[model samples]
Target: MNKNIVLKAENINKYFRVPTLFHVLKDISFEIEKGEFVSIMGKSGCGKSTLLYILSTMDTDYNGALFLDGEDLSHKSADQLAFIRNQHIGFIFQFHYLLQEFTVLENVMLPAKKLGIKSLEEIEHDAIEKLRLLGIADQAKKLSMRISGGQKQRVAIARALINKPSIIMGDEPTGNLDSKNSEIVFSILKELSEEEKLSLLVVTHDIDFAKKTNRIIEMEDGRIIS
Candidate 1:
């Protein structure tokens, strides 16, 4: 494993047994380097999201190897994988998934609190700092539901950054936003990769968005075609 490789998947395969044992992924192998920004582009049901889930260590019912930061994670226990995810992987999705009842600051702090490695005060400070970085610090005290959709997505990005994970994975993060908001989010992600040296792997159907990334992994019938 290269020291600079933040994530690697070798000969990975997945199957769905409930629906007559359909193969969802086949020989999916790829590597994402530290500070690299990559995007996965594919048609619907091409298993791009499934591959991302496996890489993120959220789906372990697959064959082959998954390595994160040079550590093989193929056989870790569920609890162990959970801990690893909290500490090493950050995720964003098409929807923000913010808890409407919680304040923006609290929403951003939840993952750090779950890790239980920092004092509440320290976690709060870090959460605020992340919010500030996303330019949503002023919304910290407001309820998550009070913010607009664009702000909500920014809040989700802040929450993802609070843990400072080795890699950030997004599943159509800009899919739910308007063009302006989508561009705003994309610029933020690009800046994070350039300035913060963060590793980002995003799955998107938007070809324009995919074109802006460092590399684009195209998939068809569960295999990387290019």
Candidate 2:
């Protein structure tokens, strides 16, 4: 494995037993390098989202060897995988999963707080800094329910970044936003990959969004088509 590679999946295959076996993913093999912004594009049920889930360590029943940041994750225990996920991978879903009752700063600090590697005060400071970097510092004191849709998404990004994970994985991160806000979110992600040297892997249906990424891995019928 190259030292510059941030994630690598070798010979990945997945099957679901609905009644009989249904193949969900073919033998997928790929590598994402550090500071790279990559997109996975495919129609619904094409296995793009399934692939993302497997790479994120959320689905381990599939046959594959998964590596992140030079660590092989083939047989790690659930607790070990959880720690690796918190410390090495940040995830953003289509919907902003912020706790509506929690203030923005508190939402962002949740991951770091759970990791328990830093003091509450230190995590609070770092969370604020992440929100500031995402240009939502003014909303830090507001409850999540009080913010706008785009603001909430940015807050999710802030939460993802609080731990400074080696890679950020987003599944339709901008799917729920309008075009204007979608562009804003895309630009911010691009900037983070380029300027901050973060590795990003996004699963998006928006063709325009896919075009903006460094590379696109297109899948069809559970196989890489391009």
Candidate 3:
């Protein structure tokens, strides 16, 4: 494995037991290098999301191996996978999934707290710093519910970065935002991948967004088409 490769999937295959064991993925293999911004694009039910899940180490019932930063994670236990996900993989979803009742800062600090490597004050400081990096520091003290959709998404990004994971995996990260907001989110993600040397693996249906990434992995009928 290359030292720069943050994620690699080999000969991956998945099937649904229902409906007579329909296949959902076919010999998927790909690598995402450190600091690279990559996008996975396909229509609905094309298995892009399923592939993302496997890469994120959230789906363990696949037929192939997965490696993350030189570690073979294909057969890790559930507890081990949970720890790996929290410590190494960051996730951003189509919905921001912010805790509406919590302040933006608190929401961002949640993961760090769960990781329990830092004091509350240290976590708060880091959370504020992440928010500042996202240009949303001013909203830190505000309740998550009080912010606009775009601001909420930014908060989610801050939360994702709190652990400083090696890879950030996003499933339709900009799917719910307007064009203006989508562009804003996209730019932020790109900057993080470039300036911060963060790796990003995103699944999106937006061709425009996919086109702007460093590489676009296209899928069709559960197989890589390009």
Candidate 4:
């Protein structure tokens, strides 16, 4: 499905100014086909995270066009970008970012609620199924702060999939875990990408994990090196 182009980054460029100046992305471009698991590997300052942020719409001031299903993303306003993110993209980060105060079930439900998805029972049902798939359903009602790091990461994965996103982007998702746990997390991500036909883009410094992805992209000095 490479020809389908589920996502496209056309000559993308991003610059950060003030305090100091930096060209974070240098005419970078890439695409993720539907159901592909792609990994971006780079040194810490090579802009892999920055690229993911821009692609995920977490940062929108870049200089090129991003298309989702062939729709120009640069034309959208901040509110519209937020709405699109809510509707089609789910983000997972190294830090799990679960609200420590919220229960696992609550954390997963927050995004759906924010998007005004109706039928609370139905949403809960879906969320519960995700948690079950990730092996955390038994802890769904427990506070996130009380879970183990691996368990917390599982919660984060479940949260990311709760919306059934068309694309899920993760940055160093397994960076904080031990080898055993990292493999667990990657397997879950791999399962979801295949089982749900979701395009997954992950950035990682772990070469072993990166190599396991369907496509391994190497970056250096803000450019794709391989």
lDDT of 2: 0.95
Model 4 scores worst on lDDT over the 10 consecutive residues at 1-10
Which regions of candidate 2 are displaced past 4 Å?
none
TM, every model: 0.99, 0.99, 0.98, 0.95
lDDT of 2 by residue, 1-226 (tens): 7999999999999999989999999999999999999999988999999999999998889998999988899999999999999999999999999999999999999999999999999999999999999999999999999999999999999999999999999999999999999999999999999999999999999999999899999999999998
Model 4 alpha-carbon drift over 4 Å, by segment: 1-3
Give the whole-model CA lDDT for all candidates, comma-separated: 0.95, 0.95, 0.94, 0.88
Which pairs clash (backbone N, Cα, C closer than 3 Å) in model 4? none
**Models, CA RMSD each:** 0.7, 0.7, 0.8, 1.6
Q: Which 10 consecutive residues of model 2 have the lowest summed lDDT?
A: 57-66
- State, as a TM-score between 0 and 1, how close model 1 is to the true structure: 0.99
Candidate 3 per-residue C-alpha lDDT over 74-177 given as tens digits, one digit per residue, 9 for 90 to 100: 88899999988998999899999999999999999999999988999999999999999999999988999999999998999999999999999999999999
Q: What is the lDDT of candidate 4?
A: 0.88
**In what order do the candidates fall by lDDT, top score first?**
2, 1, 3, 4
Which ten residues in a row are the worst by lDDT in model 1? 19-28
